[model samples]
Target: MKVLVTGGSGFIASWIRKELLARGHSMLVFDHQDRRQQLADGEEFFLGDVRDATAVTEAAAHCDGIIHLAAVLGTQETISNPRPSAETNILGSLNVFEAAAQYNLPTVYAGVGNHAFRLIGTGCYTITKSAAEDLARMYNLYRDGGRITIVRPVNAYGPGQSVAAPYGTSKVRKIAPSFACRALAGAPIEVYGDGTQISDCVYVADVATAFVNALEYTAVHGPTERPVEVGPIESVTVNDIARLVAEQAAILTGREPVAITHLPMRPGEIPNAVVTSDTSTLKQIGLDAIDFVPLDEGIRRTVDYYAQTWLPGYLAA
Candidate 1:
């Protein structure tokens, strides 16, 4: 299959691209930025934004299916700037769904699992993502749309995740990268609130596999009646994550563990909120064989990546 992957230059999409190529599928990468260095030989690249309906349609024209992953991410980032989040997450998703309907293509919609946790998930990012999921379902039911499988993943983290500002293009502060980068530099690891918020952190590779599996299922069995959720099913507190990153950094750099500090919870964030999901649906899509990377190992790998790739530059800066 020739798949059109929106946000193909992003972290998770990089792993998805590898999975696609390994499975003998070609790619048509559609993103606002050109990270052609990530593209494998013979795969095509289309420079465009998902918010541009015409551009999305043009990219869809040449692909067998679509994997819509582009969006303005970050809870605090989105909360501070809701318009872009709504425009990108909601409007951009609509454009992608419309293009898929036009092309009669099978598509995999990336979603946030916490959007379903009504009480604590009322932030701008969750609301916009929830709206986008609704749009996907509406397109499938009312618009006579093509098969659209929604894969809602919990907190996804891994080696290739970008850091904030001067270090990387991502403006969002993700937990894994934030802690890993700080720890590697022997800087204090900052935890929001009491650091007890429970998160089900799934590795990027596993998340990518789930997307591909869901995509394959849509191609074979048509659209799923409900969104398929993916996660490790195990939970960890925010403080646990910080400590783990510090420990791993110490091992990697032969430095003492950094201090873990607590800050008031950021706006739009819920303190001690447990974000998780029922991942049984993954089994239906043939992902029962996956051995999810444990959190400790995943963090070690993430810290190692930062220690080797970005820490030196970051420390020098």
Candidate 2:
């Protein structure tokens, strides 16, 4: 089967591409070569932008299906430069759906929790993603052959991530990075608001597997997997993620954590939102969270990855 993956050069998209290829599926990538070419090698991608209808159509022309993971990422990042965010995340998705609708193809639409559900104070990223998901669903309503599945992941974390987005750099690094960076700073972790706000987090590999599984399921059956939310064994709190990170860091360095506190909650944040899709439905469709990675192990792996690859030399030292 030939598969088209938009934003194929980014963290999640790259992993999704590899997973697709590993399954022996021919792959084409629909992402702008906007300095992201560094992440791709020769003979790997089709080289196009999702915003360009002509490019997107050509890329999707011969593909069996598409795993739509291309989008502007990170909360603060989207809010900072909403122009590109809107163009790529929202309009780009529109182009994909339009192209798929014309070709009458099957697609798995990837979105985040905040983006799909309208959490308070959500940024343009979520807004666009939410719109895109709806557009995909609407396309399903009109086209008999177009199958659309929506999967909303909450702040996916782990190796191969590039975390310097506005969200991370602006000192609002979601739950995971906020904790890991604090631990690296030898400062106690801090939770915004009461720390009771909850969200899902999944390892990148697990999420990648989920994407492929979703694509396969849609291929086998019709895309009825609306509201697809895959997470770890449990839903966790902000404090839970923080404590876990601090605990893991202590074991890694043999030092006690300093201070863990709570600050003001970011405006429009979801007070409590933990979306866990019914594995039974996924199972029925030949998909399962059978490879769910434990949070502790995932966190340890993520911390090490950031420490080694992303963090500056000074930060590591």
Candidate 3:
């Protein structure tokens, strides 16, 4: 199978590309930025924005299937600027669906499991993502019969993840990398609002595997009633994640474990987040979470990766 992955340079997308390639699928990447990473032999790259229908259509012309992952990330970034987030996340998704519809191609898109239910607040990211999911459903309704599989994954964190987006000298923070950075620097790991908010953190490898399986399932059986939810079954609280990162970072960097401190929770933040996926359905599709990386082990690996690969260079600069 030949696959086109949007946002192929992103954290999880990179893993998905490798996993798909390992499965003997030809791959093409369509992304806004110049290819920051080297491509595997026989893999191809195209520079384009998902917001452009012409670019998306041309990119999908030679591919048998599509894994749509391009979007503006980060809660704060989306919340701070809703317009661009909506334009890219929601509108960009419509463009993909349109292209897929035109080519009569199967598509497996990235969705957030949290957006499936009514949460405390609908932040810009969730709003746009949910809208995109709806658009996928609409495409299924009206398009000329193409398989549209939606995979709503939990928080995906691993090596090659970004802690901050570099713009000039300022930085926009992300959760896992932020905690890893503080742990490496011997600073306190800050937990918001007493640190009891639960999050389902799934390793990138597991998430990528689920996505590949989803694409395969779509190719065989077509679309299903609901989006296939994929992630670890167990949930970890924010405080526990911080402590684990500190412990792992201390071991990797030869520094003392940092204290876990509390700050006031940000506005529109949910008190607790518990992610649940349809495991029976996932099993039917041949995806099992039994082999998933445990939270502690995943944190250890992530911290070690950041400490050895990123922190030293960051400190020197």
Candidate 4:
């Protein structure tokens, strides 16, 4: 099968690309970043913005399936400029699905989840991504062109996670990236609030495997009727993640952790954010939960990766 991964250069999307190659499928990575001109060795790269109907149509034209992963769903990125976030996360996703429908490409919506609990907190980012999911489902029902499934993974992190700095309160903290960067820098291992807040984090490799699994199911079963595949990744607490980071850093750098301290939990921090993909629909599509990697091991590997690849520069910063 031919699969197109939008945002294919991103940490998670790249993992999906890797999984596809391992499965012996042809892959076209559809990315808009100027710096991502080169595919990661195996993928056939296509340059396109999900915001462009034409570009999305052109990219969708060439693939048997698509894992739509591109979106600016970060809180700061979204609330900082709601227009672009809405356009990209919502409108951009619409184009991808419409194009998929037009060309009848098998489509899987991978990697979109809410940090904020929609029923409780201010939820611009959640609202937008949720809308995108809804649109894809509707397309599946009415258009009758292709397959549609959504993998709403919560707190996806592992090796190759983002290290970009934050923009606002809405952005919150870069939990995994910031923790790894701080630990490597020998800076205090910071925890916001009591650090008791629990959340689920799916390992990128496991998520990539989930995508591969979903792709296989979709191909065999055809587009899910009332189509959707929901996967709730493994969950952990912020404090536990920090402790694991400190532990791993001590092992990696051959020194004790500099500090483990707390900052006030910022306003709008969800007390506990737990998300599950709609479970009833999973059996309908012939899907089940993928084997989840344990969180401590996942963080250990993530810390080791950032340490080797980005630590020297990150510490310099």
TM-score: which candidate is best? 1
C-alpha-based local distance difference test score of model 2: 0.72
**Candidate 2, residues 1-317: lDDT per residue as tens digits?**
78888877767887777777687776777667654454433225667878888988888887878888877765656677678878988889888887877777778889775554564567777788888877877778886566888776656887766543332543335566657766765777777778777766887777788788788887888686456776655677877788888877776657896578888766445556544444454554455666678888899997776556544654644
Question: What tens digits encode model 4's per-residue C-alpha lDDT throughout 1-317?
Answer: 88888888777787887888888888888888754555656678788889998988888888888888888756544555678768888888999888888877777785455523655764467768878877877886788784677766667788867675531122335678788878877888778777777755667787787677776777677665643434444455777788888889889999897687998765445655444455455555445555457777788889998889887765565
lDDT of 3 by residue, 1-317 (tens): 99999998888999998999899998898899888467887589999999998999999898999999998875656677789879999999989998888888889999986784434675688888888988999888877855798888888889888766431122446578889888888888887788887767888998999899888988888876678787776767878788889889888778789999898876546666555665555774687787788888898888888888877787887
- Which scores greater on lDDT, model 1 or model 4? 1
Q: Work out the TM-score per prediction.
A: 0.95, 0.85, 0.94, 0.87
Clash count in backbone of candidate 4? 1
Residue-wise C-alpha lDDT for candidate 1, range 4-123, written one tens digit per residue: 999999888999999899889999999999877767875888999999999999999999888999988877777677898899999999999999999889999998878865445556
Please give the distance, in angstroms, between residue 60's alpha carbon in candidate 3 and its true position after superposition: 1.1
Ten-residue stretch with the least lDDT total in model 3? 165-174
For candidate 1, the per-residue lDDT at 191 reads 90
Distance from true location, Cα of 231 in model 3, Å: 1.5
lDDT ranking of the models? 1, 3, 4, 2
lDDT, model 2, position 284: 41
Q: State in Å the error of residue 282, model 3.
A: 1.9
